[model samples]
Target chain A: MSIRQIIDWAIEDSRSQMTGTIVSPFYEYSDYGGHWVWACDVDLGENLGVLRCVPVAANNRELIYAEQGRAVTLSRLNNGKWVITGLAKSLNSTVHYIFMSFTDDTYQVLRKQLRGYIIRPLTYGELGTLVVPYGYGVLPYGAQGKFDAEGNFLEIVETY
Target chain B: MRNISAALENIILGGGTRRPDYKVYAWDPAEATISEVVSANGILDDPAPVDLTPYVSDVSWSDRQLTFALVDPAGLFHPDFGELRHCLKDGAILRLLEGDETVPEVDWAITFTGQVHGQIGWKQSRSTGQITSRLTVFGRGETQAYKRRKITSQEYTVGTDIGIALYDICKTFLGLTGKEMRIPFTLGRQFKHKTNQLAQVTPWDGVCSLLKVVCYQPFFDGEGKLSYVNKSLHRPAARLFEDGDRIKELEVPECSQDTVNKVTVTFLDSQLERVDGPYQKLGQAQVTTGFFSMHETLETWWSEDRKQRADGTSMKVIKSVNSGILPVGSEHYTQLDEFHGQIEVEISVWVPILATVMIAEYLAAAFIPDDVIVLGFGASEGITIPVGRIIQAQAMIGILLIMMSIGSAQYEVWGTPYDFAYLEKKSVAVEDGLDYWLENNLDIKNDFIGTHDQADIIAMTELSWQKCLSMPRKVSVADDPRLEVGDIIGLPDGRKLVISALSKNIKRGEIPTLLIEGCKVLTA
Candidate 1:
């Protein structure tokens, strides 16, 4: 596709990702209190896709106010790699994690497990990075690493 | 019981006997016939009758009282004459007869009458050689007394009568009169060795003592022999000697050389000088030349030297510092005496920059974020932002920050640089130093262009562009003739476009406002 077309698709996809269906684990504490999980597919029209889930109150029909977690979507570009973007809200803190992305790899999963968040301008092919959304006081620390083929384990290289 | 005259006569006669056979008799008035008969015989009759009646009847002949009642010529008898008669011996001159009557005239009897003048006759006889027995008596003693010669001149010295007066005058003038004047005539010796003894004496005693030693010479008129001179002669002479001549000649050897004590007194043409030396005023005896010397030294030390003035008084210059006077040479800390034009410009541009940097350092530690870097831009075009733009940025941040912090709300800005550049151009610096900085560092055309893009971009958009376009611009009409009604404006290209608005919409209040406008670029 042309660059304009690509930009138009990215814009449309960003909008859909912002407003599409969400999914999360269904939970019920009583007859009057229960949450319904919904999901939407973010597709870059090739092999790259992201499944997003949000918890909606069954009684109120509103999205669940999740704390310390986020909903995200991953898309693949023409280069056959994936970029991720999402909205995150951290409860009881001033930090708000904004849209960010990285490639489709176990490195992203390792970053999600270790750092609990992600950010844009993903660098160092196997080492996933994140934006901390820190204010004047908050600092983020992590070690540089690589993901094995199984993508279940990470190999530490350096720390910063 | 003894008569004084008789006693006196006896004492006088005790030394020598020179009798002229004188007798004192009384005249008998009853014996006048006998006195007549005696006078016929060539005898000198009684000069006056003596009264014998009272004496013959009253006296006893056994006392040989040939009482002759005599009367003095003043008609009073001597009071001692009766006592003299009582002291006469018994059987002495036992006769009772009148003055002219002698014993009864008998054969070969001598007659004793008044005033018998005896003529001594010479007889030449055959048995004896020639005898010259005539008495040659010159004259009888006269009844009047003798007069004495007078004195004319005399001499006196120190404490004699005259000298005492001189000493008194000296003491009165010199406060030394009552004392013996214990002054030294020689260096080591007193003129009068007996001054202590003399000081004890009264004026008279001192005078007498002085007189006993002094040679008194008297000038006298030679008349009678010295033996016959009476007391009157010597007494008056001594008085004159005391009063005049002696005092005039009196000399005090101790005071002879005392010139200060010398007082000359004149009587007509005669002048007398006090014979004292080294005298001063009475109260001033203790004063000396050394005292005056000390006074002069103190005056010299206490008195400051005065500079002579034209009016004859003196004054001194008082040095004072006048900061208003321009300092000469290198000591001046100001450029008041140097080239005046551009120094103010240079100083004004740099001073605030340094001051702001200092203030920024202080603020950065406190309220400002540590990451908020303070760019120390120099004066070069590439390095330093124009001062007008900087000031505008600061004002914008201050306003926006106040609104955000106090109102608890966000604010939006239309992206444009025109407003800020307009504000920078129109805002007048009210102070000298700031005005100088604005004039030198801020080029109006360049500042207008540079801040114009930023102001236009900020004014065109409705987004929260306050942070991206930090500089503030106040809306104002463009004074430049080159700028027109429509313009396309942008900030430096590297920065993002925070917002945009059409200049026409801004003027009509459709968009917020276009604070500044950039250069017009038209495309057909």
Candidate 2:
């Protein structure tokens, strides 16, 4: 086999091995209609390997949108919009993971897990129009990057 | 230059029915960030909070003077004047934006931004029965913060790229982000900075000196970002100022006072000198003590000498390693004259014996022996005396006599070599027997000329600039809000003038006139 085929096989094997739950939490709905899930149809378009997900709020829902060849975390706010929190490696096949919680503590645990990575909070405007991220503060941090990827706090080097 | 919309340019060229007007805004320094203040436009929601356009009067802005007045008649302004007073405190931001009367507020472009300086003074006119409060402010550009940051001591070794050093200084000391700076690509001139010489200089001056090496000047554009510019580059004409244009007055004066037929640049040069080593083995001995088998290795290298520069002053040698290379040991380090010397030595090991290896490297510098000198090293045996004593003992016994004098070993003497200062001058004569020579002996204290080629380039640039400065024109025109510093205006005589400095005053119910100083005029 060619080197590219060998690399693809190794990547597929690694992706298969990493298909497990990173974190799980219990959630309950008052309506007894089962916990709400912020699931959306995967949009790969002409590009089949990449997943294009819109930012949404997930106030009271579980996020389960997934695509092939890519792995990412989607957090839902109480307002039912889902947002991308972090990116992941190892996703050779289509996989979906639902993360549901009753409080912000579960997301805090995930934030602690992916410390230094830049986490963007995707939000929506009135009329259900998706508000594209603009300026800087759209992330949880507004130009002030606090935690690094390894969960280590960085020292602020400049003061005005 | 700030790019204006075509409609705005038409308004400036006096082609529109609506005339240009300016609005002033004020923000407290502690209450708002510069990014917010810079991007603020009072369209719907005011970002700067306070509008000072109603009370602002006698507004004038120039390179040297930026002053305005706020008039109050029997306190008719009431709470608005009080609010304006609160916003006009010291260090408060004063922003001026220009737009026509009928245009949308978003079309207004910022004309000037400054910070309040000193105390706001008040004066009363009994005849007019009105009290005037005058406020003076200083233009705070991008380099203003860097001008306050002082670097006590810093050094860049010879062959250091000027561009990278400047970027490092801006990033480390000024805390400027990558987007805030636009340094040109690395010109191939190497820069060397002496720590003692640049012991106390602000980052602004440091940046200016580095830019001066490439004949460039540092300036802040309208967006308040630091940029390097070379005026020698020809720029296309921005606008033509001819008849029917709103020009008040124009004068082109020819003077030979600034004409240069010669330019002299004095720079320090490193002159190399070679000195052989003071390496010698006084004596070797084999002794067997209470051990079954023993082997020992002993080697020594030492030098003692002093050299002076061509200026007849004692040379000061400094140990400096290249940015990435590491020094081997205390005895194996590179040293050069503190002021003007380049590092030309390669790192290598010198072995003396086959069985045992010795790393002998000499970057030795001049030594001033005002007192006693002693040199010592360990031998094969455990107990030992000083090498001087061993020499004395050998001389007293007369059996193992070996004279260890100066220049005994065949090794290279490594120390700071004497360097001298030389003047590299370039000249261009415009006419024979009519020499209008303007010479400038640049003080090495102010100029950073490290290499000979760099000095030549700087001298040529100075010569060209001086030649261009021979013809300066002062032009007075109606205030055009679209006009900016560094804009080129075409003259009537098929010549182009680059606007170097400008002064203007904006008043109500009257035309604002501009005074422009064009330092260089080129053929159209």
Candidate 3:
């Protein structure tokens, strides 16, 4: 079960600014094999924060990392009008993945969480602390799946 | 559409009657066995006139009993057949040879549930010294054991699902093997019975009759399980006699003027009556719409009423039926065991109606309203009703199950009344009734001419599925191994046919002769 927290966020553009709550835990751990793996947002370059897994023996869980003290402001949106409409958290083992939904269904901030370098356990080597560090290489904004030379997402181009 | 018609035609009509090449296959399910009888009969010395006569018993549903006699030497029996007399106990299949030792693809059949019921003794012929022992067997598929059972004390709501109910009933009561029973027939609108009480009836007959009443086709497959399916829903396998098709003689019987043009089913409520054991009445309800009338009744008992009482402590009885699944799992029982000083109780101390017990009570009736089932919780030792619910005592519904009887439904089929069609009414106690339907085609019409058969539903005012079984047509084409009982085939004249019965001559290595009997259905 993944635990996601929601908070209001502000996207400030010089001329046009819109405010919406941050869809917490935008990253999810749907199919972790219990093998310790890192979830890093660095590769995404959007600095959205990492998604971490907490293996509390009695209640093992997952959560998206929100860098401590980071302002409640969002990453660049390239002028895409999206509003975080609702926030939810799931701790039910029956749920395969956790999510942070936005008003726009087509809004695609999802990415490769387990794609980088690996770790052996859920954070603490003792398995008691049950915390893991996120590790992955940072990519150029365009190289990551966010945009193309024309500022249009290749994913959207191929999907349509 | 696997078209094996051309292949069947070559063998059916192109044969040189000199002892057509074929083999006979018989399946004995009681032993879970199959056999090829290439030479079950020694010789057909006087095969002049084949004695293959197919008799559909009026007393039986689509009596596919293939009756024929073959002479053999005295006391000769196949080792595979133990004691010879018990050879036909549960179900046995008979199909003509399609060639080779392998089971044939095309032929006639029946899982003989009735005994060889005919004589198989010595016979004397006139003028010749060839006195032989003749064996006469009436292979039948009539297993009406569900008729001997009944359901009691339980009430099923009007909206209860008919398919799930029947499936559960057959699984719980019919005692059929996992593979022996199936419910694959698709129905458009499910039936919801008002509380209709039945007393000692046949659920098998009820379900089958209900299928006919609703115009759904139900029958046993080659294997022995009882399953049903809507014939019209089936895609036409092959055109029987298309123009320019390599076909044998096709005969279309003239419509008869003696056909009836109306049918009525009436089912009365049986909730207001006496229960054989110590039980308290719970509740009852009734609803009637011209098509059907439903009534529901329920009852329970007091657990403290029969305490073996060593200390006989006084307590209260619990009223009200909303215990919410009873004291609840282990938590409720633990609470129940903690005795409260004194609380006078009324009605069953525990429950107003045990859902599990009530479901078991009406499982057969609720699911398959036409099946006859009688359920009694348990009349054995190690099985005792749980006692001391909450503050007082009363009979736990699960501890004691009253027998419920569900009456059989009789399906009536007919043409548009103006068609003047002399349709053959297929009388069948479902060997297998399946549930499936296309939402777009649910409105199959039941234009009646006659609906009542030997069905035992008293107030059965109207048939549920307004469709009628009105066609009584028969076609004799070369037998195709791919055909089955409920298959709906298109004829040359654009008339669709649902195969009702099939017969074949085992001695002549004959092709299968299909019986297209039953009420005609108007697909359009």
Candidate 4:
């Protein structure tokens, strides 16, 4: 019913192909209403790599790779490799499984739709583990996915 | 000495005196000849010390005199002589001796004579002149000096005109000098007297003019002339101020007792009427209304009839009245226009008259403490009919009924209407007959025909009708016996009277009628 619910449903549906599970839900900071970012660890059974994803809105997704103390950009040549850049915490020595998820709405519409969903009844401690993860990757390979609960690929919606 | 003489000459040429306060003499030796052979008889030709002293007596200088002898006949060797001869040549000089070996006690005299020689054969051009002068010399002693002494002398002459000019220059110079000294001085005193006099005079003239305009005097017979009376007499010490400072103190003359008495009479007649009489009447009226229902009734009536018709007739009757008299289906028709034309002039005049009476009654009701009411209706068919009033006749009957109810209640409570007279007296009362009619007819009543008493119904109806009436009533007691019977005889229903014996005992006087209608009705 709400944008957050839609994002959660998309993330949950994408978990089958995802190599990692969500370790933390989206943490919010005020930037145009509010911005949400999350990090997760993916297994990537064949080789260990990292994936970082920033979801600005339902459709806007940026895939990154987990690196030493940062999330670095992943080139098309290194597709499916996760390189972390501008991470608040260090990911240098230990290998992490990164996951990314996105929905298909604009930030404004998404915010308006998720107003009630964002202010859920969950306490601070419970919300830490309740978040869902979709795409996953390793350090050399970045993962990407079309996040949608009803199988509709995320699409950019433009407003004047 | 020669330089000194030259300097003296220069000084004299420079317009100053070259001589001191003493005398000077010039000498020449050329005029004298040595007579050495004259003493040939004197012993040996060697000119034995022939004691020339005897000749010295004639040549010696005395005290206060000086003599010089010239030895050379030329150059600087010139001698001083007492006289110079004209025959002497310019280069001639003789030895000259001067002596002052004389007694100091005697004043000495010196004489010098100089004769001018004319140029050869120029006697026609030359004037004969001789210089002879005497000098009285006084000193401690005299001397013959061969030594040269330098002397300098100077002389100056001052004319009166030049001295005056110098004095003027000095005066001007002194004046400038005094200015340069920068001494403080008083220039002149301020001339305030003229300004002050003008100031006082103008204001004085203004004050006099103001007094002439504002003051009055009352003349008396056989008395001395009286000054103008000051109207500010009560406040004599009043002062006027300019810019918050007192500028003038007003003096008010004392008013005579007679004048004060007259003023008191005038004040009592005019000003005191407003303060005392009206206020007392208002106070008394307020008290009566506070305990009575007079104003409530008056207000209700005025508000209801403010824009309505005067005679309280319905629209149908009013139109009928305007149409005059007409019979049904009569060919001899009375058209409304004709009927109105016939009555228009009379109605116009009569309406104003009735309106004047009504206005007078309203003014009396508003300001006077006497009950006065305007009955807006007149009886039409002698059935005590009130047809043409704006308010229903029954409504006026209601005011009377209310008043009678109050009166009877007061009588029952206090034993007499007079006992509550203070509570009943009012200046104005307006009754809206409509409100009573509506209330009595439309309002629900709980009790209905429970008591079958005819007298009670009559009494209640009488009281109710009195309460609804709007006519004025005066309270008084009957005073005459014969008039009582006459009053009963004038009643329209007198033949139907039941209590004749009791009616005979009633006193007669002109008390206010209690009927709500315009006409007065008698009752026995």
Give per-model TM-scores. Answer: 0.12, 0.49, 0.36, 0.08
The lDDT for every candidate, in the order shown, is: 0.22, 0.46, 0.31, 0.20
Which candidate leads the pack in TM-score? Answer: 2
lDDT of 3 by residue, B218-271 (tens): 555443346565543335544456664434545545653322121222221212
- Candidate 4 lDDT by residue in tens digits, B7-28: 3333323443222211222222
lDDT order of candidates, top first: 2, 3, 1, 4
Off by over 4 Å in 4: A1-160, B1-449, B452-456, B467-469, B473-479, B482-519, B522-524
TM-score of 1: 0.12
- Give residue B363's error in model 4 in angstroms: 99
| Model 2 misplaced regions, further than 4 Å | A1-160, B33-36, B39-47, B74-83, B125-128, B141-149, B153-164, B167-198, B221-223, B227-229, B242-246, B253-261, B267-302, B305-450, B508-511, B522-524
lDDT of 2 by residue, A1-160 (tens): 3453456446534432111111111222232246453332222211122222333234423333222112344444455434444333211111111111112111110110111121111222211222243543343321222224353434221111
Q: Can you give the lDDT of residue B304 in candidate 1?
A: 21
- Compose the digit string of candidate 3's lDDT tens values, residues A1-160: 1111111122122323211112122233432455543222221112112222312121213222222111122233355422222111210000011111112111111221111111111212222321224222222111213232233333211100
Interface DockQ of each model: 0.00, 0.00, 0.01, 0.00
Poorest stretch of ten by lDDT in candidate 1 chain A: A105-114
Query: Against the true structure, what is model 2's DockQ?
Result: 0.00
Off by over 4 Å in 3: A1-160, B1-63, B77-115, B118-121, B124-127, B131-140, B144-160, B172-174, B185-199, B209-214, B229-240, B254-260, B263-471, B506-521
Query: Each candidate's chain A: what TM-score?
Result: 0.18, 0.19, 0.15, 0.18
